[model samples]
Target: MFRTENALILREVRFKESDRILTALTADAGKMTLAAHGALSKHSRIAAATQQLTYAELTLFEKNGRYTVREGVTKEGFPGLRQDLGKLALGSYFAECLEQYAGEDQPEPELMQLGLNSLYALSEGLGSCEKIKAAFELRLMTLEGYAPAEESCPVCGRGDIREPVFLPEEGQTVCRACRKAGRSLPLTENALAAMRHILHAPAKKLLAFRLTEEEQSLLSAVAESWLLHCSDRNFPTLAYYRNLKL
Candidate 1:
């Protein structure tokens, strides 16, 4: 049978001679691996379509419940990202995360939109990479039911949040008094405010918000802790970001 859909290139790996195994995040299918034979050769449509970070329309054939790309048409190629190494690595990391977290046969239309929007923003918005990463992580976790709450305290039943604490293990904030007795990642008032903004800010506001360097550092650390705690794997790309100091 024929299956036609839009897809985002999540990853691709060489398969045998002149073939590549492409992993794509699609509108109807979350993630899929397809073999494109001789795809790297000149004048191959599959080669053109399978580039990472490409948003393409694919015509596929499914036999025995496996999807194979018969042909593809490029709709949007995130070329600007390719020009900047940081953007490219960041995009690749996000693509890998999308592929790793979501698997084939579980469709998420909104997540697809978020991925596209982020790539577009990388091209069009101010190069505030930290904001973009945080925004995506915030919304991605939220969509996955992990976004932290903005309440006065997310721990110990109740407390007015004069100075909230971010507990990486808990994935939320706790009151200062409540935090003293519990395991937590310590955070300052300014960092707490930044976290609040990350939790509350709408999509369009991420690139616009002005965050201090110190706040960015704190937010980055907190986010890393949260992701590491949740994903259960060290994000080497994120570690690369940490080394870049931006």
Candidate 2:
């Protein structure tokens, strides 16, 4: 059987000296690994189609639970991404999320749209990279059914959050009244509200979003804390982006 779809080459590796193994995040299929014959050769047609960060229509030859990518052509170059390190880092971060969280052959239409929209925003150097990144993380949390309780503290149902701290392992938010004395996550109300807004807003408007510098710093802290608590791994790309001067 043969399948075709708009896909991004998420990862690639050399195989057998002449062939390559490509892992793609597809619009329809969440993720798939395909064989690309001679992708490294001098006159390889598959090379262009399978370039990392290149969005393209991919044709795959499939049988016995595996796929070999046969042909492809570009749909969008996202040229702006290559021009800025910050944008590239953001792109890489999102791609990492796709690889780590999204399951294979389990279509996530919402995530696909999120990826497309985010890529566009990154390509254009949209003014709110921090906002966009925060929104994306919050949306991803929502998709996983772990969205923070924005209307009120997840534990005490308090309308006012004085010092809200999110406990990712427990997947809930705690308010000042309910906060344990030694809990290290002392997040500000500004951060919590900003995260809540991003989680609740429509995806199309995520990139156009803005946050005050104070709110931005707080939001970043909360987001970094949440993601670290959830994934329990250091995200080097994110660290690099944070250090980057605007």
All models, RMSD in angstroms: 2.6, 2.7
Task: Score each candidate by Cα lDDT.
Answer: 0.75, 0.74
**How much lDDT does candidate 1 score?**
0.75
- Taking all chains together, the TM-score of candidate 2 against the true structure is 0.85
Model 1: CA > 4 A from native: 155-160, 181-194, 200-208, 240-246
lDDT of 2 by residue, 1-246 (tens): 888888877667888988888777876788888888998999998788887777889888889998988898888778898898888888878777766677787886777777777777778867567766777777776777767666766666777865777665565677767866554455577677667667877877664445677777667666656666677777766777767845
- Candidate 1 local lDDT, 1-246, one digit each (tens): 997889998888887777778888887878788767778777787887878889989888888977788898999998888887888778877886677677568887767877888888775655477767776776677667788765668556664565566777767687777675556666667666666676666665645555687777667667766766778887776666566655
Model 2 residue 197 CA deviation in Å:
2.3
Each model's TM-score? 0.87, 0.85
